[model samples]
Target: MQLISTLATIGFVLPLFLALVGVLLARRDYGVAAAWGGGVMMALLVALAIRGVLRGDPDLPHFPSGHVTLAVAFYGGLLAIYLRGGLNRDRTAVPVILATLAAIALLEGVSRILLTEHTWVDVLGGFAVGSLGLLATGCPWAVRRIRAGSRLWLAATLAVATPIAFMTVGWLDGLIRHWVTL
Candidate 1:
């Protein structure tokens, strides 16, 4: 349980750092960053709504795991995008990174289930939500425009939005931690 929790924590924290790095070092386009951020935001809202509706109580919602949702949406999405040549030049980098991320996500999902933090269904839901997020930003159709100054604006917006979104989710989860606990 502890091992799983640690892995889960790492998986959760990794994306925030990666997002920062991608934005600052990799010079990821702002629109892409916005897509990722937007996906995360969407997942949170959807999860919260599902929890409220199914659980029949806004104060004690359930069904989807927010942690898993964010992990899959942000980390999984980032990994998927990166593997597609978003940031690396080395040919060998993709496989290694993919394997490592896959392991982390798989482990996190399994642990969450075993620990009763979430059901398998919830985890799957998280994965689906995350995939949607990835698609939202990664799909070619979604990023057809490359206007000048767009990157700067998007990056600046994400620079502010990323941390704020992370903190907001953290605060929200903290508020409902007890109620949502498995």
Candidate 2:
């Protein structure tokens, strides 16, 4: 369990750190890449949920957990973007930003531990997922799509996809829970 927990933490946090670097190094494209990656991951999770529902064997009961991941990724990415956009105006800005994000991360970690809904690894795994998101969408192809199409397309995709993402999270969570009890 300790090994799993430690690995989970590394897996979860490493990606975010990498993504942060990418975002900071003028690889703004990585930010979009991360967002789309999250969307895709959520979509896959949702698909699993639908399958479980049709089979009448909802497994996990951890949809909110999925949302928690999404929230972290979404908000973290947003903060990264804001910082990149020159919001770090004062010298204290960077520290303030880091502190706030750290607090959120700590809260998330502690909350999961207390709730017992997830192990440390599971919570940290969210961080890993978010990090991969940063790398996955940073490819040149993705940049082209974002450039060729209007922001409207991206926005529309998000609007339609968000609910699907949430549903998928819920459904898979149920399935996982059901399976574990068996």
Candidate 3:
């Protein structure tokens, strides 16, 4: 449970995989890609800020689970892009894929509790934060405009997210150490 939860923690897996799929199957429009990544970024930063301020348990902040937030916001945004990109044919796999992501998010949340990394409140907070982030980045709005230099936005996101990913490897013990820590 710990291992799976760790692997699912917003590292570079889901977004990268979805990006590649978008490039291969869809038009690889920068709007969709940028929005998806932007949503994840926004959610993560916001969640971290909340955790810092609220202070969860004695270790790291515990109001929200960043892993669960990432799973929902990032994976949920991917579903939005996948559907909005207009893959009308062969719709059979959509539900299956969507269900799989939902299951992953749910299990990740549960695993966090089982592993004592978070509580029910943390998981619920994660869901809320993730949803807000997804909504903020225009996920369900279907922004497909292919403006110039949109690809640069994705590269920029990667540049920003990479360093943060390192932080998730092992959070600071007994110290509120997020970039947004108050």
The candidate scoring highest on lDDT is: 3
Ranking by TM-score: 3, 1, 2
Q: Model 3, range 1-182, lDDT digits (tens) per residue?
A: 97658545544454454444355334446566567667877888899788777775564468788878887887676566555544546789779868976887888899999999888988999999989877965754546644344434444555565455556545531133343343
Model 1, 1-182: lDDT tens digits are 64644433423354454545455335545565566566666766677677667786543344666667666765676564454434334568667767877776677778788987777887887677666665665666435343344445435745675565555544544555656443
Q: Please give the RMSD to the true structure for each candidate, in Å.
A: 6.9, 11.6, 6.8
* Superior by TM-score: candidate 2 or candidate 3: 3
The lowest-lDDT stretch of 10 consecutive residues in candidate 3 is 173-182
lDDT at residue 67 of model 3 (Cα atoms): 77
Q: Give the local distance difference test score of model 1.
A: 0.59
Name every residue pair that clashes in candidate 1. Answer: none
**What RMSD does model 2 have?**
11.6
> Which residue pairs collide, candidate 3?
56-61, 56-62
* Residue 146 alpha-carbon offset, candidate 3, angstroms: 9.2
